[model samples]
Each structure stands twice: as C-alpha cells, then as structure tokens.
Target: MTSTPPTRRREWLAPAGLIALSLVPVLSGAARLTQLSTGATITADNARFFDSPVPIVVHIVGSSVFLVLGALQFAPSLRRRRWHRIAGRVVAPAGLLAALSALWMTIFYEMPASVTGPGLSALRIVLATVMAGAIVAAFLAIRRGDVRTHSAWMTRAYAIGLGAGTQVLTFVPYTLAFGAPGPVLHTVLMAAGWGINLLVAEIVIRRRARAMSARRGRPAPASVVSAPLS
Candidate 1:
C-alpha cells in the first residue's frame, strides 16, 4: 500500500479546518448579528447599525454559496474543455453576485461609526473589489485559454471570500488563550482571518509560478531509442 503524500496531507488540513470553523457559529447558538468586543457584550441597541437581519442573511448566504462553488472548481474532472467553459459561465456570475452582496451588506450593516469605522469599511470595500476583479479576470483568462492565469486569479478571489471562515476559526483559539474580551477579540480575529488569507494567496501564487516555470523548462519527451544491430 502506498502512503499518502505529504502535500495531500497538508491540503486536507485547510479544508478540515474550514469545515470545523464553518460549524462554529451554528454550534455556539450565538445570534448571527451579535458583535462582541473583548468579553463585554455590546447590546444590539448600542450597535444599531447591525440590527438589520436582511444584510446579515445576505452576507451569510452569499459567502456560503461562494465557498461551495469555489470548492467545486478544484474538481479535476471539470477540467475538460466543455465542462470548464460551462462551469466558468456559472462561476463568473455567482462570484459577482456573492461579492456584490457581501460588499453591500458590509456597508449597510456591520460598519461602526467611530474613527475605525470608516477605515474598516474601506478595507472591506477594497477586499470585495479585489475579489470581484479577481473573479472577472479569472473568467476572462479562461475564455482566452489562459488556464494558468485563470487558476491564479480564481484562487486569490476564493481565498479572500473564505477569509471570514478563517477569522472565526482563529478567534476561538485566541480568545481562549488570551482571555480577551469579545470586541477586541472579534477585531483581532477578523484581522487575522484576512491576513491568513492573503498569506495563503501569496504562497499559492509563488508555488504556481514555480510549477509553471518548471513545466516550461522541461524537455519534450524524446522518442525511445533501441539498439539497432546487436
């Protein structure tokens, strides 16, 4: 029996972590709208901006849809010309809708009114824009038969969209270890989530670049040579 490759083992870890993290919100029985700062509870009345359930629902549904579709993109069987084109048509619009919904929800719901409010909102806006641009570019690259570029951009977009899940995962450990209050802990976890996603994107880009370079450098398969007159 053959052992699993180290790369396969490593690849399994992220998806496993994502699966566990995705279930946390549901398991905790916390209101999806609740925002915690440090250990202290800030009442919904105090953070009136997030009181709307519509935006929260939109964000949750949009992100979840993106995550599920993004996972399907890794299916090797879908790499065929026909399936890839069909999937591209579906993914492009779905990704656009998800990014737009997340962006609008972020603006209308969760933004704070303090100094950091504008900054954080701006960051979310920028991230959403990046996600949208990456998705669009990925689609265009696929149309042009540029698979390498398409894969890279799509990975970047997916990474950013998945950042939310990573944030929740990081928060649990940090909150327990530091004993930080809810608000501060939430902020720290959000930052950590984006940071990790960016780091992952960079690592992926570098690896893909190296792989592409190696493929280009490899010599074409030579014809098998046999002894002529032995």
Candidate 2:
C-alpha cells in the first residue's frame, strides 16, 4: 500500500497525541470509580474521596468524557464537519461538570495536609474556576457567532482540563528522580504541569490566528493573538 501524504499524516497527529495524553488520567479515573464502587479498602491517599464520593465521582466521569470528546475536536477533519457543532453541545456541559466538580472537591474535600497545602489548594481552586469560566465564555461566544473567540476560550478550557494528564507525565520522572515529592515540591510540580499546558495552548492559539490571517493576506490582529488568556 502507498504511504499517506506527510501533510495529511501531520493533521491527524495532533488529535492522536491529545487522545494518548488523556488516556492515563481517564483510565486512572475509571479505576478509582471501580475501586470506590467495589468498596476497596480505604487508604490515606483515598480516604477523602471515600468519605465524600459524589464530587470525586462526578469529577472523574465528567473530566474523562470531556477530555476524550474534546480531543476529537482538535482534528481538522472533524472541525470541518457538522458533528463538530453537535459535539460542542455535549462538550460544553461535560466540561462545565468537570470544572465545577473539581472546584467543589478542591473547596470541600478534606484532603490530607501532606497531600494538599494552602498553596496547592488555592491553585486548584483558581484553575478550576478559570476552566469553568472559560467554558461559559466559549458558549457565550458561540451564541454571539464569534467563532474565533469561542475556539480560543475552548482551547484554554481544554488545556486546563488536560492538566491531569500532564501532571502524570511530570510526576513520573520526578518521583523516579527525587523519590516522591514533598508538599512544596508537589505544589510546584502541579503548577508546572498546568502552566506548561496553558503555555502550549497559547502558542497554538496564536499560531492559528496567524495562519487565519495569512490565509486572508493580513496580519493577525492583537485581539485575536492575545484574547485567549485575556
């Protein structure tokens, strides 16, 4: 058989990579739900979730759905189709559930002092709020027929939601090298994970804006370039 064209191959690569990145956390979340449902023995690490299972359950399921479906949206093939709009209807609510549940857990779940200190807790709350707000802003933008603004907001929301996957990637090598991080290190690494994802999101947003401008034979306007985070 003949090989696929390089351009076509590259187009699919991004969505494929996004799906791969999402697998670990999504699988882990499923396992957690399984454990909770099966009444697995509670440990220090899992006691908080066990005590108040609803929020964690909602978070795991919602985020899992959001990540997988959201990944498909990144595919240029899907973006050009009608299903992108249909999927957005589901994706928006799923994303809101994920972000709002996370905010609830961060604020109400009594996590162990060793696991979450003030700084990490604050970081989580802020990010969850931002994620939820981004989703809402994207929905509103779409309602107003602002496609670029909608895409930018949704991209930022997806980046934040994908932070869980990035955290796993960041923590694996770190735990191996440092033998399990302390609270301070844990917070720092968590910040780094989310920060890295957001930074990448910004770059993608800017590049897309530039590409659209190039197609129109004009410079990317400042609003399009910087509106994602702002």
Backbone steric clashes in candidate 1, count: 10
lDDT of 1 by residue, 1-230 (tens): 99988876766565555555545433332344344323345564435333455655555555665666556555444454477566667666767777887688666664443313224666777888888888887777778877777777777787787776777668668767776545544555676788797777767666656666687995322111110100
Query: Relative to the true structure, how large is the alpha-carbon lDDT of every model?
Result: 0.62, 0.89
8 Cα displacement, candidate 2 (Å): 2.2
TM-score of each: 0.67, 0.94
- Steric clashes per prediction: 10, 0
Candidate 2 ranges beyond 4 A from true positions = 1-3, 228-230
> Which residues of candidate 1, in runs, are more than 4 Å off?
1-56, 75-85, 110-118, 181-185, 218-230
